[model samples]
Target: MTTAPPVHRSHTAGNPDLLPLLGRTPLARIQADLPHPHPGFWAKLECLSAGGMKARAAMSMLSGARRRGELRPGAPVVESTSGTMGIGLAFAGQALGHPVILVGDCELEPSMRQLLRTYGARLELVDRPAPRGGWQAARIARLREVLARTDDAYWPDQYNNPDNPAGYLSLAAELIGRLDHLDVLVCSVGTGGHSAGLVGPLRRRWPRLKVIGVDSVGSAIFGQPARPRLMRGLGSSIHPRNVRHEAFDEVHWVGAAEAVDACRRLARSSFVSGGWSTGAVALVSAWAAGAAPGAVVATVFPDGPHRYLGTVYDDDFCRAHGLTATAPATRPLEIPHPRAAEASGWTRCRTVVDPLAAPRGEAPAPHIPAPGGAV
Candidate 1:
C-alpha cells in the first residue's frame, strides 16, 4: 500500500538535493491596494520553485513511486502536462536521477521549454488540441505511445492518482500554522489536484471553513458544459477524477477578460504576480471577503505573472483577444452568468453539482465513452 505522508507544519528537516527548492512557501495578506473592497484577504503564492505548487505534488508522487519499486532507477518517467506540472516533474526527475519526457502542445513558452531541456527532460510537442477531447487527450495519446516503446517508464497519473492530492498535506499544515484562523479557501480547479489536496486537510482543522472553487467559464469540471477555455493550468474540459465534487461548498466561473484584468491589478497593487488562477481566485476572494465581512479568507495562487507576460500582461495580446483593462468590469460582484457574457466579472453557482450530469458516485472520467473521454 502507498501510505500517506504525515503533514509537516514546518519545512522538511535535513533535506538532501533539490528538497530545499520545494517547500516553506510564504503566504501574503492583501489589503486596500486591491481594486475591490474587502475584509481580511490573503493569497498564497505557489511560485517559489520553477515548478510552483505542482512541485509539491511532484515530490509526493515521485517519492511514492520510488518506494513502491514501480519506478526503476534511471527509468524514463513520462507524463502529459500543460506547463507547471511538466516543469515540476523535470525538477523531481533530476533530483531522483531519472529521465523525464514531457508531452504537451507545441506552444509551450520558450523559457519553460528551455528549462525542461536544461533538466535533461525531453519535450514531445503534440501538433494540436484534439477537436473532441482537446490538447489533454492528444498529449495522453502521445504518452501512451511513448510508454509502449519504453519498458522502464513510470507515469505519475496526477489526475486520478491518490498520491496527487496526498502531496499537499504539507501545504495544508503550513497554512494551518501560518494563519491564526482561515475561514474561507478560494482555489482554482485544473486537474483538481491542489484544491482537493489542500482543502480536505484544511476543512478538517477548520471545520467551518468554506471552500469556494474558481474555474474557467468553459470548464466542464463544475457542472458547466465543456467549451474552449483560454486560461491554462486552471480549468479542465473533462472532469478530473481528482476533483472531490463534494469537497466544494460552491463554485465560481471566471472569464478570460476578467482574469487578465485581475492579473494586471494584482501586479500593480501588491507587486504580486499571481498567474492565471491568481486573478480568478483573487477576484472571488475579494468578493468572498466582501460578502462575509471580517471573515479571514485565503486563496492559492498557483504561479506568478512572468509566464503570462506575453499573454495576460501584454496589452497587445489583451487587445487582440478583446481582453483589456476597460473591457472587463473591475469590481467583483454577485453575478452568476452561465453563458459567459461580455462583462468580465465573477459568477457564483449555488448548485455545486450539475443537475443534468450523472451522480458523483457513478463512473469516473476515464471510464466515460469517446470523443469527450478524459485522461
Candidate 2:
C-alpha cells in the first residue's frame, strides 16, 4: 500500500504562516478505458494548493529576492502574467507583506481578474498584443512601464528566473516520497518552471526517468510559429530560457479543441480535472501510459477548473471558439523534428531542440533514449 507524503511548511525560509498553506497537494490516480486498456496515470492535484502550483514559485522567488536584498522589506512586487502566475504572486505578496501589482492582457478571464483583486493585487491589462510577441510581450512592456514609476518595486520575471524553477524542489520531494518507481513524467510547458525544476531531482533518483513536455498547438516553444492561442496555462509566444531543451525525451503539441475535450472527459470520468494546462498534460499522459504498457506515469494538474468556468466549461464560450467534445486521436502523429511540419492537432516529436540554438530545418541532435533504449 502507498502512503501520502508528510505535510510541512515550505522548504524556503519565507513567512512561516503562508508557506504551510502551499505544499502537500493530493496525488490522485486517473484510470480510463477509453480507446484501449492500460495502466492509469498519477496526477498531482496542484489545484488544491492555496493559490495554485505557481504559488510555490511565487513564494520562492520573493523569498530569494528578499534574502539577496533585491527586494527590500515592504517593497511592491510587479510582474506580467496570463492568469495563474498573477494569482500566485497575489497570494505570495499578501503572505510576505508586499503590495502586488500585475499586468495582464485583455484576453484574461473576468473570473481571474476579480479573484486577483480579491487577493489585494492591483491589476493592469494591456489592450492589444505586440507586433512580434503577442499578448505576453505586450504585458511585459506594460509591466516595465509600471516598474519604471513605482518606487522600490521588484519584478519576479517568472519566465527566466532561476528561483522560479528552484521553488518546485519540494514538489519533487513529495513525488519521490510517494512513488517508489516512475517511468514517464509528463508536464505542460508554460514558463518552464515546474518541469525544469522537478526533472533534475527526480532523475537523480530514477536516472532513466522519461520526461515528456506538452505544449499548445500554436506555441513557439517547440519551434512552432506563434499564432493566436486560446489556451492560457500552457504554451508561449516567446521562448523562455528556462525551458530545459535537453531534458525532455519527447514533446507533444495539443490543440484547444483537443484540450477542451480531454478536460470535460476527465471531469466526467475521474471527477478531478483542472484547467487548460491540466487538460493538455492529461491528454498526452494518457497516451504515454497506454503505449508503455505497465510503466508508471505521472503528471501535474496546474489549477482547479473554477477559474475556467467562463471559458473551458461554458457552452456558449465553446461554441464561439468552435470547440467541441470531439475526442482526440488515440495516438499522436509522430514527427522526425520539431519543424517537420506545423502541428495543428495532437502531434509528437522525438528530436527536441533549442530553437534559438538550431536554425530552422537544421538537423536536430540524436534522441535521448528512455529506459531499455526506447524513446
Q: Among these predicted structures, which one has the highest lDDT?
A: 2
For candidate 2, the TM-score is: 0.91
lDDT of each: 0.75, 0.85
**TM-score of each predicted structure versus truth:** 0.86, 0.91
Alpha-carbon lDDT of model 2:
0.85
**Sliding window of 10 residues with minimal summed lDDT for model 2:** 366-375
TM-score of predicted model 1?
0.86
lDDT, residue 19, candidate 1: 77
lDDT of 2 by residue, 167-255 (tens): 99999999999999999999999999999999999999999999999999889998877888999979999989999989999999887
Clash list (residue pairs), candidate 2? none
Error of 1 at 151 (Å): 2.3
